[model samples]
Target: MPAGSPKVPVKFDKVQKYFGPVKVLEQFDLDVAPGEFLVLLGASGSGKTTALRILSGLETATAGRVVIGERDVTNILPKYRDVSMVFQSYALYPHKTVAENIGFPLKVRRVAKAEMDSAIRDAASQVQLGDLLDRYPRELSGGQRQRVALARAIIRRPSVFLMDEPLSNLDAKLRGYMRAELKHMQQALGITTIYVTHDQIEAMTLAHRVAILDRGVLQQLATPAEIYNDPANLFVAQFIGSPPMNIVRGGLEGRYFLTNGARIDSPVGGHVDKAILGVRPEDCAVVAPENVALKGVIYTTELIGDHTLVTVEIGHDKLTVKASKDIHGNQGDTVGVALRREHLYVFDAASGQRIR
Candidate 1:
């Protein structure tokens, strides 16, 4: 099939899955638009992989429905799902050459040799693996082998693509490169894709919309910016960022949030006995003692190229601040941390839900 072919949307309606008494997925519902890239992101055992497996027919849904475009595929077998899956392991046949591997799907469907060869060449060309077509999988580098797997998956021109952490095996640099390659290829193909990964970076970079799962429940589904800037709850606020959001336990008294003998101004009105205050590293700054939101001692400093990560010790907890590279600090140095009032997030301490 050619790139930019007409694609189909994928849907999961009240999908439930279980293994004995363990419920892996509970009342899951999601809709993936045609040609849109949707990422299922979560930590281990969060049901992201289970959700992908159900959609690909690798695992059956205990109840509810799975739909592909206009067809209900809730009970369909893997072979009939009309979707291509790329696994983390790169599932390439060691004995097969790159060309043979890419053409295997076509061969299985009994496509003509001429048409199969044409499709294989096209797929390999898209992934820049045409030059290594005659080479066997054992001889290729990890990235190249992954390209072969991707080429094979795309060769069939399926209506949808289901990828489960397909870039996890690669090193950091290679993974970054492959991420760009995958994103470009997916856009060029215009196929509805559902990607599963625990990597927040991957989910942020690849998805049109991200579905964040925690335990067996869907926490939030939104654009990366929305997920980062406006998290639905404490779990999402803490999980989506690099250093993660710094959450401090405190009590709300009127417009003041009190913690560790420090009182910080909050826009959230009213009072609460217990509350959770969240602020991203970039949104907090190191300021002079008198004009600060909270006062603490420097705990650690990491110079990460463009910026320096400064962690300040506050009582038993630490809050990280993304400071300028030129900023200098040492352990145990008395410092003041200032939070951007407009960027501060508040959540319910007990329920972990965002407090608007």
Candidate 2:
């Protein structure tokens, strides 16, 4: 967002969608703050794309309202809605040079020739594509093509920017580089952007707030930090983290929760009978045998470059712990693990909701 630019609010009120008899979205409600980067995250068939398509005017909702700055855009045409979209495929014209591709939108809007040239040059520079302006899409690298796509989107200077997995095709190294670049570009442009992705890391890294959906229902809408540190329910706790959280089944025993045969003080909420316990890999620590919170035998130690991922067996279940670079633990070793009590997550076994 620019220093003095006004904010644009986007809202989805009671949105619903169905494919024949199958419902893809149900009573979906979301409010995106002005200049906020909101990511819609979910697995395939989770309706994330459908939501984006609805906003893009490519798909119509069966019920509900899509609003941009208080205007009901549910029935508005994509071109008239002041929105620009960048797709995963780049979707660049094969024979058109980068400059022509970017200037197409401006030309469509009848922007004056001189103004279009200026806008195209500025957008090309903004995306570091100035040097490649004469190159056709077929002559560019994957990253270069993506930049051209981004440049085209920026040249429109629309109020809202919609991106659907714009970096899914890049290689690992390029994906990482572009992730940071995309974040920086979005911040610089200050557009009200809505990004849709199935990658949890992308959602966490790029979003001001994430809106997670599953089975057509919204599970959570919150800041990335809040969603990660304080999950609203079991699905959120399980979905937000890399390697996911360690969810162990336990029974309440004598004011403490017992996993396998090891005893640890119960988290704040428990029924003294049964509950689901969750601990992040980072929160699980290796401790002296006598001070161990749980006794488990190391089943495997996976070296993931910078850190070792140790999976320990407690009873019949396996719990993964992220070991620091300097911490050494071998496979099949009897390890004493201590789980941080304050960071423990407790959820209802039946409802899957947080108990405390």
Candidate 3:
């Protein structure tokens, strides 16, 4: 907490992983700055978990190195790596009380009885599980059980925390509450954290930086805002947003792109035969007839409290736009759609990489 305090950093150098003959990670490299909350986000089987496993020393990298605080730990044992993990399953002993579960790690390390007791109490209080310390695992709710797991992790006072979808078991509401708590706890502890999850919302809200993975490849790594606003590729754009990004198949006409037989101005000026246009739902708007760049029939409308999602049929593809409920429209009616020119994202159709 002092100004001259030392800092720790986690770095991955050209890491690769293989399960027997199948390659699961390809030259993966990443850096987690000291006291940073880094999130690894991807779909199932995207190698996010594998990367975390490698970092926690549960799984070894087939090639390259893993370092923490300037130390190469590629082949270090899990218990001696100065890292604690909170798994999706919680991994709590069903027969043990909350206090016992929280003290399990200290017990394994043969910590002094008095010191172990103090650590258990501190961890329980940190996670607000002090009141339920005597309760068995089955007596606690899903959220409480998750806290128990987190308590156990924090008690170790490890330099880094590795969490793999630790809150995935809880209900949506509980997950949201725990997310805020997790971030606050990380700040209070000032320990570097590497979180692995498939939920983009979780990554956006809790992480200082997010690494995106897909099919055993590291796609893009950036701050949440950058990844959302300036995605490096089509996959990152489509995967990071809810309802996903509105990617439409279109062709280039001069410096403009053709969208549903209408000219949508392109930010970049070169002549290309084909390309795709990506527009976030929030950036797409409904405009007056003549002001519209593209025209399409409203396929469906979903009103979710403060905003509404309108799905429109633009030629053969459907695109969604977010708008206020006051803006009235009905299904099957023709509506004018326009994209915020400056906010448009252009990507190469064939390569699926960002062109602008």
Candidate 4:
């Protein structure tokens, strides 16, 4: 393939995987656009990694099909699938120098020595490892080793890139830095990439679209903003946000949601004996009890640098509210939580599906 050639799309058509009687992927269907970064996000055993592994030809589907662009590659060998993978462990050769490791893929294909060296240099420079080509993996930092793995994957210039939590091994600071780096590199390469990670932050920051899975079933597939703002169901609403979305089990009466001796005005009015009220932390504000919708006592407060996370006790449940740094409150202080009717999400308590 020529450099900068138009990338190809990846498709999973009713893809299913099973280990004996347990189904790991339940008729999963997704389409990844050309040059797009799609992140598969879920907690452990959610089948996110299994989906990626199937796409990369590391694992075969028990049924359904895997297609890469115009071709059906359901049973193709990993090497023949024309895709490269960067693993979570930064699978670099400990004894091999950076140059050797980066060039190993090209070398396996029997590229000319001169051409391989040029490609290695270009890939190394792209990742800012040009000067460390002669150093071994043991001599480099975690981030540097990850870069080597990335460079090796990129050197192939494959149609697709599979990344399985490639930044999970790095420290918090390093992971943030590398997330930016990975985003930039993927844009520069314009390759179809499927990234698997359990971290919502990574999925939110890096993906053009996020596919959220739960227990082998795909819950939602949409852009990060859409997923965060308009969650399809209770699982999506609860899984994507920091501190998670506050879900209060209550009853819907007339035009109000009744919960914990408090009633908040609801835009969607209907009588339901049981319903779930969803709201993000940032959507709730601490305000004077007389002007607020619901009142609660402060259970605890956490200073998270930019803002303070205030947990308020509402009956038996606690709701976290993101308060401005300038606001200060102590435990046991009675405070009011102001919630906007527009920001409140309503879900069916029985089905865990959005009411809207």
Point out where model 3 deviates above 4 Å. 1-7
Q: Which stretches in model 4 have alpha-carbon errors above 4 Å?
A: 1-5
Off by over 4 Å in 1: 1-5
Judge candidate 4 at residue 132 and give its lDDT: 99
- Per-candidate clashes come to 0, 1, 0, 0
Question: Residues 137-192, candidate 1, lDDT per residue (tens digit)?
Answer: 98999999999999999998889999999999999999999999999999987999
Tell me the TM-score of model 1.
0.98
Alpha carbon lDDT of each predicted model: 0.91, 0.88, 0.90, 0.92
lDDT of 2 at 234: 95
Across 164-256, the per-residue lDDT of candidate 4 in tens digits comes to 999999999999999999999999889999999999999999999999999999999999999999999999999999999998889889898
Which residue segments of model 2 deviate by more than 4 Å? 1-6, 253-255
Residue 272, candidate 2: Cα error in Å is 6.1
> What does candidate 2's lDDT look like per residue over 183-298, in tens digits?
99889978899999999999999999999999999999999999999999999999989889998898765457777777787667445456778999999987665777688888
Ranking by lDDT: 4, 1, 3, 2
Give the C-alpha miss distance for residue 272 in model 1, angstroms. Answer: 1.7
TM-score for each predicted model, relative to the true structure: 0.98, 0.95, 0.96, 0.97
Model 3 Cα lDDT, one tens digit per residue, 1-356? 11222357999899999999898899998989999999999999899999999999989899999999988999889877888899999999999999999999889889889888888888899999988989999999999999999998888778889999998999999999999999999999899999999999999999999999998898999999999999999999999888899988887666798877788888876666678888999999877657777988899999988899999998988889999887798898888888888988888888988886
